[model samples]
Target: MAIKPAEIKKLASLSRLVVDDKTITDVTDRLSSVLALVDQLQSAQTESIDVSRPFHIAQRLREDEITESNKIDELQATAPEIYNGFFAVPKMID
Candidate 1:
């Protein structure tokens, strides 16, 4: 499955990639090697295999905890504008 120079050119055109002659040659070589590897894989044997177990391992639950935070009055005191209990900001865009 050797990739051709013409095919690489066509691929570059379709992909909208600007590649020089050297890059095209390199890409073509790499593509050829990848295709050859795929062909080799297609011809190999894989009769007994369990492909699902590894990807479906049981997950653990996260622990819930009671947390403490600063009071709103203490935080709003640091802001320039505080309407009731909320901080106000200038309107910029809709």
Candidate 2:
């Protein structure tokens, strides 16, 4: 389907885009071509296609293991205040 200049103008207005008079025709042509391609894709036959198969191969992942040492004591050493293993902050709500 061909996109009209008026439709393009309305779309530009709705999208808050600044489309000038010169570019409106170019934008309309590009949009129309995209819509035509979409229309062509919609006419494709996919009734017999299998949906169970994955499109990509599975990636090899590294083994899950702890790589860093825990430093909670070292980190909390410089805090102004800590309570029950957590940083203490002033209450903001009444």
Candidate 3:
């Protein structure tokens, strides 16, 4: 279905969109095209189609392992301030 300019204006007002006067026709054409495509999609036949079979899969997760990372001294070298082995940042709240 073709949308009217007045209807587009009303929709823009309701949606709080700032649509320029010159671009109204473009917006209307795009909206009409989208509505036509939606209408076409709604009229498609899928009575014998199994839509959920492609998503069926056996998902397995890898086991987690612990690793050693000793970078505290290297990271603390670049801090402006450090207190009790942690980086000291400026307080923001009262």
Candidate 4:
């Protein structure tokens, strides 16, 4: 399906794009080519293709374990203010 210049103008207006007269033909040709490629892709034969199998190989994962000890007190020691184990910031609104 080829895109018309009038449709391109409408799309440009709807998208708030500033497409001049010279570029309208170029834009129409590009959009028409893209639509033609989409049409070609839609006509592909894939009836026997299996959807259950994955295209990529399964990745190996490591066991989840705690590697570091909690250092909340050590980290919060540098904060300017702390309230009930949480950082306190100045109120910005009433």
Q: Which candidate comes out best when scored by TM-score?
A: 2
Question: Can you give the lDDT of residue 54 in candidate 4?
Answer: 62
Backbone clashes, candidate 1 = 0
lDDT of 3 at 91: 91
lDDT tens per residue, model 1, 1-81: 888989888888999987688688888889899998888876767777677676676887766865657688987889999
TM-score of each: 0.41, 0.45, 0.43, 0.44
List, residue by residue over 1-94, the lDDT tens digit for candidate 3: 8899899999999999978899999999999999888887768788888977667786777668656598898889999999999889889788
The deviation in Å at residue 74 for candidate 1 is 33
| Per-model lDDT | 0.83, 0.90, 0.88, 0.90
Enumerate clash totals for all models, in the order shown.
0, 0, 0, 0
In candidate 4 the C-alpha lDDT for residue 17 amounts to 93
lDDT of 2: 0.90
Please rank every candidate by TM-score, starting with the best: 2, 4, 3, 1
* Model 2 stretches with alpha carbons more than 4 Å out: 45-94
Poorly placed runs, candidate 1 (over 4 Å): 44-94
Per-residue error (Å), model 3, residue 88: 35
Please tell me which model should have the higher TM-score, number 2 or number 4. 2
Model 3 misses residue 82 by how many Å? Answer: 35
Query: What is the descending lDDT order?
Result: 4, 2, 3, 1
Candidate 1 vs 4: which has more TM-score: 4
Model 4 lDDT tens row, 12-41: 999999789988899999999999988887
